[model samples]
Target chain A: MNPFIDIRNDFPILKQQVYGKPLVYLDNAATTQKPTTVIDALCNYYRQDNANVHRGVHALSERATVNYERTRDDLVGLIHANNRREIVFVRGATEAINLVAQSWGNANVAAGDEIIISAMEHHSNIVPWQWLCERTGATLKIAPMNARGELLMDQFDAMLHARTRLVAVVHQSNALGTINPVAEIIQKSHAVGAKVLLDGAQALAHMAVDVQALDVDFYVTSAHKMYGPTGVGMLYAKEALLEAMPPYQGGGDMIRTVSFERSEYNDLPYKFEAGTPNIAGVIGFGAALRYLQSLGMDAIAKHEQSLLAYATDKAESTGYIRLIGTAKNKASVLSFAVNGVHPHDLGTILDRDGVAIRAGHHCAMPVMKFFGVPATARASFAVYNTKDDVDTLFVAIEQAYAMFS
Target chain B: MFDLRSLYQEVIVDHSKSPRHFGKLDPCTHQADGHNPLCGDQLHVYLHIKNGCIDDLSFEGDGCAISVASASIMSETLKGKTLGEFEALFDRFQQMVTAPVDQPVADDGMGKLTVLAGVREFPSRVKCAILCWHTLKSAMHADSGVAKTE
Candidate 1:
């Protein structure tokens, strides 16, 4: 019996039809369908406990602050961070990365310093380091990946040196659906005395991540990818490192006190969270984490592994279709190209059939260029997605093939 | 279900698969690059204008069916047209695709290009169908920058 049976009911949006066909949303890598609990959390916060956090003299403020900080506590457990102070909420992974780049990057990196990243990194991870390099005259290095989309550890090892200050790479390739060997990457970077930051935007949604076990210096993820609200994500840093790094922004809650001569900053997480945060989104994200925990990440991973295997086998049977990413260790995402159809055209046909998939560069143009394709159509699965969704995806692929070829 | 036929007409598919004038034109009077970053569709439009008339033109690029077909059809239609005539045709083609779907587009002057009016139904794809024409317009004006359909 399928354990995920009737799980689709939890996501109210899944019941809707698109173009008169049942909506088979396969774009989980892009963003997930929010569960009813997450939606209710959003509504409940606004309907009852809507107030500014961290500065509440009133009852509503205390309730709002309690709920908002509860997410930080949930995140500490979600990623196995050492403490609540280690988890700072930002807008999303992009903002989280930018915060690290500006705060820690400005303080630590300087001329002749090296920052290493993988070729499969999304533009968010790449651009910030480039900006850092441009600002401080630091040199940026790219760790190569093979045709199969797995990172070349030997090449990466060779690139690392004492000059390599930071090694930032995606925990999972959103474009290729490859789960990189992050543990090995971390250990190797540490041997060379380089700090590592994992772009956990895709990883947290599909797998169990323990930052303490990984011993990663920094980790960032978006809540939306994990069936939570957008514009709210968390950054996990070691307490010592976050303490030493300069604050990312300055405003109301981030500071302890201000005077004409100087202003004192707040402690740990609050120091980084400048200005008004996404109070409701954070509350919704807390609910999202609870929802995922209720299902158990291990069970979810096991279910998604089987689904990915099923989808891979089905895609392989199509002799003309080419799977873009064939890493030995991959999950959730199935990026592919039909023999004659451009990804954009295939995407359009699939949408007409109500099988929504992500097509094009997927914000990883370097990966596309490496694979020698202009773009690829990606069908990523989530917990609510079933084998039936995989079947619908293949049917749409055939329809696109028939129309284009 | 929305019929794929409305979007992917037989001619559009044919042109996309076997695009006409699908290469660069050397010794061209003017040219401009075109790119749609959203889908990664990119193309170069080249024109050889003599006495203010398009003497020869060609394009080379990778794009979706709507874009490749639109460009292929445009290449064939504008072969002997003057600069002024190209502008008028561009206006008519632009109007046909951008106008309200309920409003009927006149087919009298559009010829084969009328097939692209189907894009009015898919707003996201309207940019794909117009990328090459925008590039061509840039080429006509001798603009050196890449024309983008955002």
Candidate 2:
């Protein structure tokens, strides 16, 4: 079955009109449109199974509790994590990374210790480590990326030393579309006795992820980018590490027992997940994962690869257009800039034609600086996207070039 | 009524490419800097005010087309006007950009400024189109000892 026709019927928003034209959304890197299943799951949870879990002894609480834990199990299978204890739900990937940096990083990293990160890291990955470094007197080392936006593995190897305590990198650059060798990175970092955290916010939706195979110490992802609800994310950590790390917040649900003298923390995943969880959002995320599973990740990757190839071909055909992030192993992102037009202007013109592409640093300012350009227009693809979407983008870009010319 | 192409009219592009007063005035009496960190847009406004009247005005900046053109037109609008008159003109300009298209500038001649009316349709860019005017307001206030430009 054609995925476009099958899945386009699931997203009602895709059928709507923008600027008197059908919307061609290419901003999947930023956020994806939700399917009917996920939307229905959200509404059903709120209407039928609304209650506080783990505390209440009522019927609704039991149903809510079962559904919530079921999401943890689903996420375990989705990422191929060893156990459900490894998956800890948080607000989003930003908060998840912050949890690790504040809890694990602050505990492990000391003065003169080093935390290595890549030049392609998002601000979410950069700022947390910087904060940890500033607090702990640890130095933050940057592993630079080559012109193609691929990290130099040799340089990364050189940067790792006895003092290196952690290696944090983005699995796929949100701006550049470069897919890093995360499994190799994990192995290399582990060989040097350093823990590795993969920011998989942009990867989980595009390709298949196997946490056990990658053997990363921590893997973080956001649901909004994976065709689910916003304000919900997951952090997959080794069960041993999750048990060893301190609680991120002092709150109600994270405590096993609270006495006047002292308090004992909850088990592996629950220790990190404090206070009330996003119940509806988690249900929606489970629905999104099931939807992807039904479609199969290999098929989705194949579809996106085709779209990326078409877009790259068409965008390159436009003379004077420079495509940034030409890494050999890339996902479905095309970041480019025209010689004479600013990215902001390009985005404006594209929006006029109902083509939604992100036009800024894309929250990766250091990558922009490394490329020596202020910003670039980014077109990202997903399962619902089609080659016709690429054609629309090409026509719009040509129109933009002609307007400026 | 909502034509996206009109927002990027040829006139706006012309003004952006070759702004009317697009340079720095050295030894100027009043100067101010404005920046939009979101888009990395930066501008420096220099005004030569003598006896409370504008003698010269210029700008130096790197930005997108809308911002560059807006700064250029802002310099042209305030070249020879007195500080008080410039404030009134700025108020009129702000009203023209932010107000509905049907609203008319009561006393200020805003017909020439209507070229910027297209900016109202794009809300995210209104800040870019008005950055120069905001700097000019701050610079004029600084010259009159109302407050520091910092």
Candidate 3:
């Protein structure tokens, strides 16, 4: 397959029209658009295999159970987890992190125990640990970053002490597009017997992730950001941790038996997934993974890298456009602010021209405060994005500058 | 190159570049701050009311063209109106922006605010356009003075 030429055909939404112009969607960091295969999988599941799993005595139930379990196997393959039992489904990355924080952090972390996180973490990663620290009397320590948005390795090393219980870091920053050294982070945390959880919400779709090789204790990702359905995500934890931690919720599927005297819990992954799951969404997520696998992550990464380089060159040459998030190792995101033009106004003008870029903190307010700006105009790329899209952005930015100047 | 004329019309750009009353009122009686955190647009509104009528009004903040222009025109229109008239105008403004129309024009007394009648076309930006008005209303009803900072 010609990586760039062929893959754009799979996503039907790429052909959409916004304000009478062809849509140039560069908001993949927010949520990805679905491909035909994922949409078809959703429609097929509801049309043919729509039934409650595990308990019903009907054929549809049996089919649903098989397909749902197949999704678990797909995730196991995708992340290269030790076993299928390590994968637990949740609402999204936020809920998955909350589950670990509330269940595991509450149980293990004690007063004065240190939980380390980086400055680059999204609010989802930061707020949960803050809540846990407040509830458990644990202290939250931050691993600071340098001026260029790169994590300060020396600072991270200094922050890790014997009291450090867990180190949570983002695999790729949603706002800055920085590809963090999670393999190094896992190695360092493990050296001090601290567990590591990498927020793969932005990383999973853009890079190749192998949980087994990285030896990460826990990893989380959201489906909506991966061209799959929303309200469905995966959490990969070490099998031992899953067995030791208490279940996050209690309901029908997570129980083995219940009586007035005592109640027995269900097995591994089901213990974490407490209710009738988002069956259709899970099926679609599996299909999205299959679609990605077919395209090959290495090819997708290469295509996106080229697009990023092209965009960076275009924005730099345009003059008066100050690009933010210029980390050494970054993904295909171009965040910038034009001279003398507010990001909100630039976003408005671009939207009128059928170019969709996110204009705000990108849900990483701490990063915005770090940069000393209230907001930025971010144009993030995906599998379907092309050089023409970047050209459109450059043209719109030039017009914005001309209007203000 | 893309054309900025459709979205940043001359009137809209004019208001954004040279916004009227784009500063704070010292020792102001009524002041409120408005924000649209989603887009990071902010407006600080200040009004001096005397005898239930607007004696003076001013604004200060950072926002898109539509938002700044809306605030500028809103402040200009609100300059001599009574408190009751301001409330009525707020309702009319809300209706004009939120309601569906085919090529709606800003025929209301508020000049250059008519430029923002184009804002009704972009549903997401309606919040940006109306943020200043929301701040004004909150300022009008505050016990001391409400500041809606986000």
Candidate 4:
């Protein structure tokens, strides 16, 4: 019996049905279904402590401020960052990357400098570096990956040179389920005197990350991908780096003393968080962290590993199905192609059976181009997913294949 | 509730399986590429027109079953029709698919094309059904010769 079977009951949305069938949600990579704890935290914050944070001196403001700041403290422990001062909350991983690109990139990156990214990065990781390169005349480089979606470490090592400013890559590929060797990547980058930034949007949900242990310069991720509410995520940087980097956006909360002549930036996190942050969303994110802590990340990782193994075996058992991203080390994602059936059509047919899977490039168009497929059906797992969910997924795949054939 | 049979009708499945007029028209009078950026579905609609009337209408590219079937049925229907009739039918087809599921759409003369009316239930697939029509419209208007449904 699966130890995590009863954990499915915590998510109210999972109990519902679609088209008179039980909703077998396999789209965890896109976004996770929030547990009741997260939902209640969001509701309770609005119902009782609905006040702006950090500015007001009243009791309600203090309550809201403490709860919002508590999430930052929680995140510091979650990722094993240096401290709360190293954690700066942003909209999501996209904004966190933009913050690093604009504040840190503009300040440090010069003309003819190099920024290296990998082939399997999502558009969010790719576009910001492109914009920074365009702004600063820096050359953008890409480290290629093999057919199995594993990054070429030798090629990556060769690309790192004296002028390489930042090496930003995905910690875990959303399109393929490849988990990159970020620790070794960071070590190589640091050897070349280049700061490393990891887009952990897909990684944090599946595995435990330690920013200090990785010795990464910057790490960014989204809350929604980790069973929390949207519009709240964090960027983790070394305190000295964030201290030196200019403020991302100039606004009320980010400034200490704003006058006609000159204004001083607030502190580490507040300097990056310009506008009023997502208050309730942060509280909900805290609850999500607590929920994950209770379940333990190691257990969740093991559960998802076995689930991925089971799903991969089931996918291969079907003669017509071909699994994409056959990397030796992978995580929660299982992207695959069905013979003679387009992914979008497969998605529709699967939806009829209440089996939801992502069917597209998964925001990694370059990866799709590399694989030479327009799109593949991706069924990513989470803690709540079971072996039964994997079985249902293959059944839905059989239905789709039957229809197309 | 969307019935799978209603959405993927026998006519649609047959057409998608072996699409009619499924190639480029060499020395074509007009052509336009249609792209659904959301799902990466792409197809080119080609037309051979003579005196504002279609001599041949063909399409080539890749898409899902709904889109391919819709394109096939559309190419078969609009073979000899004039540009004016094509526009009129386009309007009717748009109205049929965009209308509420419960509302009745007047058949007028849309025979095989009406099979796509089930797309109204699946909002996400509506673009898949109409991308070819929009591409044909762009081909008619002679814009940049590329259509995108974002």
Task: Order the candidate numbers by TM-score, best to worst.
Answer: 1, 4, 2, 3
- Give a tens-digit lDDT track for model 4, residues A25-135: 999999999999999999999999999999898989999999999999999999999889999988899999999999999999999999999999999999999999999
Q: What's the C-alpha lDDT at position A306 in model 3?
A: 92
Instruction: Put down candidate 3 lDDT per residue, B1-150, tens digits, no spaces.
Output: 234464467777788889887798876778887878877777888989999999889999887778888888888888989999898888878877776856565466755556666667677778888889989988888734433433
What lDDT is reached at residue A403 by model 1?
78
lDDT of each residue in A206-234, candidate 3, tens digit only:
88899999999999999999989999999
What TM-score between 0 and 1 does chain B of candidate 3 receive? 0.85
Question: Against the hidden reference, what TM-scores do the models get?
Answer: 0.99, 0.95, 0.95, 0.98
Residue A345, candidate 4: alpha-carbon lDDT:
85
lDDT of 1: 0.92
Worst 10 residues of 4 chain A by lDDT: A396-405
Give the alpha carbon lDDT tens digit for every residue of A1-405 in model 1.
469888899999999999889999999999999999999999999999999998879999999999999999999988999999999999999999999999999999999999999999999999999999999999999999998999999999999999999999999989988899999989989999999999999999888999999999999999999999999998999999999999989888999999989999999889998898999999999999999999999999999999999999999998988999999999999999899898998898899888999999999999999998889999998999999999999988888888776
Q: List the residue pairs that clash in candidate 4.
A: none
For model 1, report DockQ.
Answer: 0.77
Using DockQ, give the best candidate's number.
1
Query: What is the alpha-carbon lDDT for the whole of candidate 2?
Result: 0.87
